[model samples]
Target: MRKPENESRTKTIKAMYTQIVNELRARILSGELTQGSRIATEYEIAQQYHVSRGTVRQALGELTREGLLERVQGSGTFVRSSVHTHEAETSLPAQKNIGVILSHATDELNMRLLRGIEQAARSRGYQVIFAYSEENDQLLARDIASLQMTTAGLILFPLSNRSIDSTIVRLKQVGFPVVLVDRYLADMDNDYVVSDNVGGGYRATEHLAILGHTRIGFAYSRAGDLRTTSVRDRWEGYRKALYEYQRPFDDSLILADLPTDAEPDTDLFDALIRRPDLPSAIFAVNDWVALEFIKAATRTGVRIPEDVAIVGFDDLSYDEHLSVPLTSIAQQGIAMGMHAATLLINRIEKHVLGEPKHIVLPTQLIVRQSCGARLQVLRAPDEKPS
Candidate 1:
């Protein structure tokens, strides 16, 4: 029997739905909505495409299953954000591309770094792809493996507290243009760009010491196993300050290994302050952790600058607006990103010519209200070297 006219029309409608979905997917992947943004309603989408609401829902439903849209009850629908689309014409034959493998999308510091990298990559006409590991060693290994499978060059910010993995070592041995950032890998010599973490720690502690804080405690992410180079460097800095001030290097004063792997231990800070033997001041590993410490202290009725002082690392975007106004080590994250991208691009260009080069950038301390209570004599201190 011959197909009916209605059946043919239904087939055409289904094809049209596929077309609409593809068009919308293209737009989303091209960063039209980008991150954590909602799209128009199904009714609106139907009206825009001149299709039935059912058809629109079907298309969106499929996209949602594919992790392209997030549907919320009563709150409507949103675009899912976990892919990068490039405008590079495939006709050019193997265009240069860079891959960045980071831990996760957690804070503004990493976002600012991404902005710098994007600026540099777009300027040089290179496509950039990003991958995030869920802070798991196995997951990080998988990401690295995937990067090795595709991509020309890689920029990695490893996630580990103590040591480098053998998988990373194998990847480096395969002559991968892997430039590390933020964290360093032991037993492997590769191009990397990192901030002066140790110096930042030293300066923060030193600032606290100068304020007449004889008993200053250091708080960081990891506790006993300070294997990560950044952690060790910062802890060393803390010790250096204590030694210089002739204070006993009490291990109890160093709060390491936060409650979770992702962030610092805010609960510990609260408990520490509640204890009768409280340090005069505290130096936090990062700005986020510092903020948490400040909040905890405030909640416990600890007066800032009077009862307890605080200094943090990574002068984050919102540090100035923070309640206590963070005093932190200002790492040029954007500059670091730009510089790392430039280095990777140079490697890609020079692959046809020669070898790759490693780059290093310095870090600086930004004095603010949190640690300025003791610097009243100087009024405005000179900007210290990074």
Candidate 2:
């Protein structure tokens, strides 16, 4: 029997093989590599990708099975004559697969949701494929078109939250089995699974209000047009909480589009710090934004919760490890994924019949040191670091 070390190695090799297959398939679809044109030999491909000959062979074999590649035994692997053009990809019958399109594949929340989708999909005897949209609308549309050729159904964590996208509308027109995850277009009635962002926002803000924070800032984005249903819902909840607590909503404290993950934008945050009557706490859009606020505050010697309490949505995995563990709203990501996949599979297999279903899961407020509930109060920080 193979040991755990061998199992790890096998998974890595399999991942490498799948990557190679995707890259090669993309080349064929884009006409970069033409049909009936010979590709590099196993040894050459192995060298180019820095993978082993066995891995190259495995990738070629899978493509061959998919009718995208042909092996002449002696001559090298060649693009199949039938596999031409992206539009013509559906020349072959669709596979028993479910495709998931999301913003990022490596994100913790996305990964967790994918685990649930994969669990539900495989248990129903369906294979799952994934494509990343990187939050681009054009690329997301292109991905949906390409994936539909091979997959039985698709689940989208779409790029836009503002308006009804034409691509998704077309899918509905054709009656294609597709489910929207995390966010949905409010105009259309479609199958969707999402967390209760409004409640999550309300809970986070109420927590801060309970801690005696009357001046709470909503850290939204300057890119007002891109705010999705999830973001808008959260903001609505923030407003609701303020009304409930009888706190005045200050428009001046609205921090918009200060990105720190890609490139640090210190001007907005720094300007907020200079305000004479600054907010005592901040409710960030998400954990990424919360972390960015904490980072900016830490840099300027503005303490967390003490100086200004910070709370975020989408309780990410590494929140606890921060210098000040962030208090965040935890969504049922796994359950969301499972529900989405199950719903899509039901449509695919004709197991369920009814109007389109929209499932909204609940959220939990995870309190930690960042909220000043468990740690020493803010004023005790006594001195600022120079």
Candidate 3:
């Protein structure tokens, strides 16, 4: 006995509705359709997918019931904010598996941090599961969701873009145990371990000043609101150092809007090279940027330490191996990771509670050839008791 045509048609329509629901759910979870953002109207979705309005309605209805979407009386469907959701049940198993999420695991700084995390976790009989977000919000959200289901707790090294604040807040609101590493969201009460970026910046600037390089530029990669807390703190430190040295803080000396890993903005570099009033020295936000700037400057016949000097933060191991050994601020990446991991484990074990703790680790200044400090020392030795 063959099934009725109407029954077959009904099953096909239901499957279409389910497919729509899954697609929308994926968008919401991946942050393509962000929290409180409006989704396409029923007619728009129906027309786009070549499905009936009734099918779209059924898909939206399913999302609404699952607490993933909300529909207002006068407004269209919106992604539901995670704040109103019920508290997530703690589902950590006895295996003591911990999850680590980082922007880039392959980066040297991050690798050092991971080494520390692994050491600490193993010593304490805990296992670690690492995930790389590649600084993508969608990948980060997916990693977070997966970790939430299986790990005892999470240690996150958030991206500098600051797009993960809402997600982090949601996790906190749901009583998820997490410790942030390297960077933190401003005004959010959360556990974090960070380097003393301001002090590092100050040290970098002060070193240049000590080498008689009063005119120093601050070079950064990010522009506008994309600036990270570390960069901001470093800038503050630079300002403070200038104030202490009684040197005028020239706004023109600050050069942001540089190229990022995704977008190559060569114009910014050209502008820096062509600037009428170039600083005698530069304090880069990090070693990588310093290296790039040095390479660019050298190619343009800029004599380092004679025409310009450079200092960088995050005294990476390879800094010394550069053509001109870079002066930098040494951040203890491994220690930071160990501390963050320990903090998370303590929280998971209910050892700490109440107000979230914020740990600011100290930074050290490393003097090298690039900042012209070594030249100053040699010149001092050659001086005949001035």
Better lDDT candidate (1, 3): 3
Candidate 3 global TM-score = 0.72
- Residue-wise C-alpha lDDT for candidate 1, range 231-347, written one tens digit per residue: 777778888878887766686677666653455456776887676666767788777667877778787887766667788888875676566778888888888888888887777
- Among all windows of 10 consecutive residues in model 3, the one with the lowest summed lDDT is 83-92
Which one wins on lDDT? 2
Residue 147, candidate 1: how far off, in angstroms? 2.8
Off by over 4 Å in 2: 1-95, 222-226, 375-386
Of candidates 3 and 2, the better by lDDT: 2
Instruction: Indicate the residue-level lDDT of 124 in model 1.
Output: 89
Clashing pairs in 3: none
Q: Name model 1 segments beyond 4 Å from true.
A: 1-95, 223-225, 260-267, 351-358, 372-386
Ordered by TM-score, highest first, the candidates read 2, 3, 1
Q: After superposition, how far is residue 204 of candidate 2 from its true place, in Å?
A: 0.4
- Give the least accurate 10-residue stretch of model 1, judged by summed lDDT: 85-94
- Model 3 superposed RMSD (Cα): 18.2
Q: Evaluate residue 257 in candidate 3 and report its C-alpha lDDT on the 0 to 100 scale.
A: 64
